[model samples]
Target: MTQKKPTSRRQFLGQTAAIASASLVPFGALSSRVSAQSPNERPRFALIGVGGNGTRTAPVGQQFADLVALCDVDAKHLAHGNGLLCDGKADLYGDYREVLAQDDIDIVQISAPDHWHTKILIEAMLAGKDAYCEKPLTLTIDEGKLIRKVQKQTGRVVQVGTQQRSSMNFFNKALAVIADGRLGKLYKITVGIDAGGWSPEISVADVPEGLDWDRWLGPTPVMPFRYLQDPKKDTDRNYTNGHTHFRWWYEHSGGKLTDWGAHHIDIAMLGIAAAGQNNDPVSVGGSSRHDVEFKDGVPMQDNRYNTAREFDLIVDFADRDVQINIRHDVDNGILFEGERGRIFVNRGKLVGKPIEDVATKPLPKDAIAKVYRDMPIMGNDRDAHWANFTHSIKHRTLPISDVHSHMKMLNVCHLAGISCRLDRTIHWDQTTEQITGDELAASMMSRPYREGYEIEM
Candidate 1:
């Protein structure tokens, strides 16, 4: 894992520019045919995991592409999604591999569970399709590295679902302010990923007819069907409970650490780098309080939610000039504290004197544009994120949420989760990109895949 010194921003940008230039040649050759094609000749899309987030993000892709197919493990979700997309116009499948095998699909929108993300995404890229994957892109640190390697070999466009990167008032503005040094000599950043309390008891129930229970458990260990009764509907038989509660399990997700932390931590890392601080943290130490008892990081209770309920984590950057504290004391948002001023931001609002002062004293005209890698701002945040993905597909360039930077940011999230699980301080060797001197902590970097579901480079 040993590597050379990190590339400077200037060098990185220069390399990106060269790639962009080469990308144009492929599209340029097709420009004549592109002009002849109708405006409706949009890229064809196939969506996998058409549940909660998938349903919400499908329209964004529809705004720029045509939905040609839908795949889901649950028949109820598949039916609902197909109904939303022009009745039965799009093809339907229960297996994602079938959708990937279609040559007509130019893009794959992945909104599956966190555990299934890495396998599906790697397979999609290998299938020669550009992809737009939802956030917390990898389930583990090893998955992140595998993704980077595959993406490098394929040279395909992949955009992660961290939409805040394109937000106008929140992350974009926060980065602009930091880049301008309005928050001078940034010292500490506090991130709060509030708790959602413990979920009610889940009991074993009859597996619904249309659901592929085995396929749904893809890479995770096999277990009996568990369902939570819907309080509102005592008679409903669709069995929609298991889909909603997977987030609280360690096997399926990193809980709030990777759930909300995915959004806030990505922005926090951007702000840290913008303020001339190191993006990679050299060490992480933390303690977390889980709602369920645990032995060797596995929850003792098998039928209830097990992810951490509350946590207080501290991370020291490579330069030691900036420290990040992740906790549950405040509302879910990021608070950047600096020598000159401080500002806090979340989805609802971006506040504090520093942010407010931007009105009387505006940031540089190119600030937001620069944060977006000089790409022109198009519509709203979601639209802009989608626009970057589709535009990159046509132009053959990298999107804003490209694999390289996303992997680096997700690494921090994994480290925080590991530290919390082990209840000890962990040191990271940036050069080698491995945990230093801690065998048990390092071993958690990856997990064993269920025999048939292994991911190969």
Candidate 2:
């Protein structure tokens, strides 16, 4: 990977402003923050692995971004994101390290799977560029702490793609209601994600062309390409495509635990104010029940994903408790049970006691401004999230969904998944962010990185 000297703030913002004004692209209502460059100037960024979510979301990024480069291990994703660049001059690369190596890039939007997140983020910070990495911040607890350390030491702005923090209806409302005691001491939080407890037995097969299979397996142990081929070899669809069912595999994702759990449990933890404090949870407990056996069904116990297909994780948070559960169903949502009454919130729905409770106080006007972070739109708009990132870049301000807060939220997701994986009660020293008793459970916090791919502090 080639490393370019860091670009001066003036030059970076100058390039950003030129692209923003000349593009004249339609912006989401969130775009109201689009033009607010600090007196200093705007920030430019690059997109890493612009596939799936990144591909769909990067266009809206234009409202607040000067897309300078696009990168991916797969040429397809790299070319795709570059095509969305307003300047039509954005450079392209197949390896994200190359994008991070460039000193001119102010930010890197990481939309890779859970396993790839930590490596890309650590490298980007070391390269001096701020980062906008996506959710389930890391694959393990140790990696989360290491990334947190780098963020603090580097002083680089990091906005995890946990967009719920910026959502007015979910995060803002939940935070306010809890703080105001509307939830009346907030007894417990129950977060559930639906999934069918099903997985086909793994089988061997050939690797496809164009993909550097080894690169795709970065930081993860190497395996025969057949280890992940489609269970039903009759089908023409190869399961290892960049966008294949990655969420189901442990090497690429944490299944539902990190998938919806990252989103739902994050909101749940935020409402309870248990995020980021290592001394938070004194004990953790859980169970994971899979419908099939590892040798016959999934090949490797934790390869294509050893994450729980169904499980209940409980965390003791001093004054309160949190129950995180995953099941195979589509009716997903979050429920908060307090002394007063219970509140249920999910995408497109918010219902609770008195029905009027949410509207009654409506986040005091002052709180509204502060909680919404003064963004024009108060929801998870890709454009809005990107707008906040770009705005912060020039203003030298931290975005509301910053790495610290996101990492705090991510800790819960990682903890929940860890609890399920261990399937036993365990003690956690939140302040130290370490497991107290079980060495086996503690060992899973981080995994061995492939050669030349280790993420260092």
Candidate 3:
């Protein structure tokens, strides 16, 4: 069905001033329907992949939005989540497309596997729904560009679930320091993600019962499930039952690159002020170390998580030298190295330079708004990412981590992963958004989807 297109970004902003001028409308009024009508009766939303992140955030969404639907490939997860639905009246579906078909669902929260992100997001926007998708936005480099195009065409308010953007003490302070030149000529950035173990290779086996294996492997190539087996310990175990083991496989995910990189590198992208504004790395290269594997391993249980145990990737930025690395037990955090000084920021701790220096350093009132055009302001207190999304839905404004901006950030991770695989330096074309010189390596940017799952413009 053809959807009613949203007003252009410029047109929507133009109406905002007039609405504020009206004595009846509030300055930050969000609803498009205007006052005189009850704004509480707003849009309905749905949750897809209600297992890990979705299950946790489902109740919170219901408080702000009408949770009318739930979808998941796993029946167990769906049944469990359905029981907790507010008023216990939400519609449940196994297929995501079924939920997307509903006309009343004005918004959707996608917490599906990495491989399914681009497909479901693009289709949802085409069907007239705003999306809140988890980060490490795309599985491949090209997918990033394509997703951006569809988001622009549909004019949807999409928020990539990189909640750091909503934090004042974390992201806002980091952005403030960098843009104000407190870091002074920002020379290098170091990002580290802690996944905590080595990955051993594994052998393939048969598909198990009670699981829609093919459907779970949507858009990814069919491969024998690999199970992990420890030598000298006789017994066997299965690790392919859920999404926990998904990050190690290249079929559906990009190991740590998309997993932890989605978080840590996302911060690096924000700090360097390159998250939304840039695309196409001028150069890419990295090295990785993988675990060893034996032939006689348990079925579908392979030590073969495809992620590298230790990795380092360097992407040549236009002005600065940017780098992302994966280390064991270093924890997930970002470090910004500048000519003047350095600072390290993470979830639990924020330290760098000196307290007196950082405390005294203040960005001018117009600084934040000036560096990022229409970037979300993380008021004094952080932890408002989800609230920002709900507000944007009502306000007809795009969230801070919108798809267009997210695609650019995701490309950095994609290039980092590709570089690790190649283990050598490669040149890139910014305009065409393709790798130069090496045809075989360039082809690796995006793999062909399996039958019935290909995404096209």
Q: Distance from true position, residue 357, model 3, in Å?
A: 2.0
TM-score of 1: 0.89
- Per-residue alpha-carbon lDDT of model 3 for 140-235, expressed as tens digits? 888888777766555567888887777666666677777777776565667778652444455665554445778888898776655555665667
Cα RMSDs of all predictions?
8.8, 7.8, 8.4
Q: List model 1 lDDT by residue over 91-135, tens digit each.
A: 887878777666677789999988999988987776667899998
How far residue 435's Cα lies from its native spot in candidate 2, in Å, is 0.5
Which parts of model 2 are misplaced by more than 4 Å? Answer: 1-42, 84-89, 226-242, 274-279, 291-305, 321-330, 358-363, 370-380
Please give the ranking of all candidate structures by lDDT, highest first, separated by commas: 1, 3, 2
Cα lDDT tens digits for candidate 2, 1-457: 2234455545544543443344333222122222344645545778887678887666666555577777777766665556555444677766676665555567788887667999888777666677788887888787877776766655566777767666665556656666666776566677778762344544555655656778878888776564454556776555432354666766667778788877887777776762222225567666666543443223344323344677766767755434444343435877877777777788777787723665654656655445556655523646567667765654556687777666666666666666665567777777787877888777767778888777643
Whole-model lDDT for model 2 versus the true structure? 0.64
Q: Which segments of model 3 are wrong by more than 4 Å?
A: 1-38, 85-87, 195-209, 226-238, 274-280, 292-303, 320-331, 361-383
In candidate 3 the C-alpha lDDT for residue 371 amounts to 41
Best by lDDT: 1
RMSD in angstroms between candidate 3 and the native structure over all alpha carbons: 8.4
What TM-score, computed on C-alpha atoms, does each candidate reach?
0.89, 0.81, 0.81
Q: Count the backbone clashes (under 3 Å) in each candidate.
A: 0, 13, 11
